[model samples]
Target chain A: MVDTQWPVYEVFHQQARGEPHIHVGAVHAPDAEMALVMAKEQYCRRQACVNLWVAPATAILATEYQDGDMFEHATDKSYRESWGYKTPKTIKTSDEETSK
Target chain B: MATMETLQDLDAPLKSAVIDLLYRLADDAIIIGHRGSEWTGFAPILEEDIAFSSMAQDDMGHAHAFYQMLHELGEPDPDTNVFGRKLDQWKCASLVSLSSERDWAMSLVRKYFYDVAESLRLDSLAKGTLIPLAQLARKLSSEKKYHLMHGHMWMPRLGKGTSESHQLMQHAVDTLYPHALGMFESTDADSLLDQAGVCPQENDLQQRWVAEVDKILSEATLKVSVQSSPVYGGRVGEHPDDLATLLENMQLVYNLDPSAKW
Candidate 1:
């Protein structure tokens, strides 16, 4: 059978203001405008969403999972993490002890 | 004047008018929702299938809310009112009863036409004197905004798309336009509702509906000939045979076992 469907669009939804638009799913639409409308009806119908965006799946670029070496670190990178900033207490004041 | 808040607040005529109006609204939602749902797994694309299903659910939900309000006014429950009522008692327009015929262009045009009228009607009801109906319309209108947007997006796209698409869209519009106009068929209660400050006159609503539809169609380059006649009788329960068939399908399961909990 001939493929009569439209192109795929990746949907991003923002739950509320100051929130990032996380990728929810994809929908097929003939154009960007229709894609956005379909995205709302498909993904945002039951959920609370303040904003939505859709980009053609063909427009997106990504690295293959097989190329994990680009994302992997060869050496220890724990110093770059926030958890590394925590240090054992050298001393404790009476005020700190009371607060704790 | 204070708004009518409940069925008991109205006199005999106003109560009757409100019931008539509620039936018109509820039947329109239920029937149109049913027709839209026939496209559930059959739409040209999966996304459209999902979109139509969502809107169908919204339409049915709105219909149920209206039915619930009627139940408070001493009518039977939603299922009974929807399934047990005789065909002659249904108040849905012929516009909603017509089958989509599995034509994508016809389906989109029908939705665009219906959504424009429904959006305008809901906006007017949102400010009307029936407080409960007004509150419900207010809530429902927000959800209908997306439905209107869906219509707005597609009507023009297919209208201006390829030669074949354009031809199909124009043909669908020409075929469905008269039935679409029938959505404004007046009930005997229309005047009573207007006099009681409960709702706008159907004629006035139709006028606004015409202007809005024309504006959108014009932008799509689709010409609407000035219709010489507006199809009527739906508001008073006269409908094409299509409604009978649609009701059979809609009430099939419920009628099979009215007492069984599902």
Candidate 2:
């Protein structure tokens, strides 16, 4: 039994109320309760923690790391960023628009 | 029974009994804390290594709290009392000092047994009539819950695992049950403490502990021989050579620089 290592659970830690549960680390445990125990001890020993969440590593879906180019846009996609809306547009009345 | 609200309320005999009780609690924590700390680099899994180390720190902190209480009762400071004591001076049961030799099953069994007893002891002390001790016990009682949770999680998993694991857990339970009984080894202080409404009799607590632990053992599919007699000695300052060696190793670093501050 050199390699009967238990399943890994991805640990998520919430620092405080209204904060997102960020992926802290992973721990091997037989189940979720044990995973929580392991995750708290391993990931939150020195950090401020309000709560924790653990899901089996298998449950988390992710894009392949080799597909990095999928996230890189060949064209600029400034519409996705708040900075692209920095300028206020001038509103013209219907009459002004017709005169123009 | 008069309530001891403060140190001044303790008479001579009661003070002695209280000191005896404190030594039992403090020394057991110190010894078992060392045992848990030994698993720092050797646990079956990395998660367990960290968990055991964390428990070790909690045990040491509980020990320090008890020793502080002892110091208030006219004993030495916490550090001096814990680190300067010899083997026989320590009142920890031999169970905590039992040689695990890096056996994971043995260590888990020892910790599970000790945490059960410690939880029961803290609960009783917390509900007792001694104001100061009850306060400390109530605080320590909260931390014992996590240790008990750890114990509950692992015991059943190992016991109901493969056949070899089943055998390993059974062996550990059979081997350590008697020593666990040694945890409740009674003394003259029992009567004194009982009379003062401070804590229950050791035997009473042991019966309740057995009943409670029996359910978990059942779930673990392990049977304990109830007829096993306790190997009692540590309560009265009698101990094996292992304790001396443990104390020596535990104090070696401090001895290297007696005058240096951490």
**What are the candidates' individual DockQ scores?**
0.60, 0.38
Across B40-153, the per-residue lDDT of candidate 2 in tens digits comes to 887877888899999999999999999998999999999888777777788999999877788889999999999999999999998887889999999998778888998998
Q: Which residue pairs show backbone clashes in model 2?
A: none
Best by TM-score: 1
lDDT per residue for candidate 1 within B1-262, as digits (tens), equals: 5788766888888888888889989999998898889988888777788899889888999999999999988889998999899888989888888888888898888887888888888888888888888899999998789999998898888889888988999888888888888988877898989877778998899899889988888878887766646677787779888898888887899888888887
Q: Please list the residue runs of candidate 2 whose C-alpha ends up more than 4 Å from where it truly belongs after superposition.
A: A1-3, A69-100, B1-3, B253-262
Q: For each candidate, what is chain B's TM-score?
A: 0.96, 0.96
At residue A91, what lDDT does model 2 achieve? 43
| Residue runs of model 1 more than 4 Å from their true location after superposition | A85-88, A94-100
* RMSD in Å for all candidates: 2.0, 4.8
Model 1 reaches an interface RMSD of 2.5
**DockQ winner among the candidates?**
1
Give the per-residue Cα lDDT of candidate 2 at B42. Answer: 77
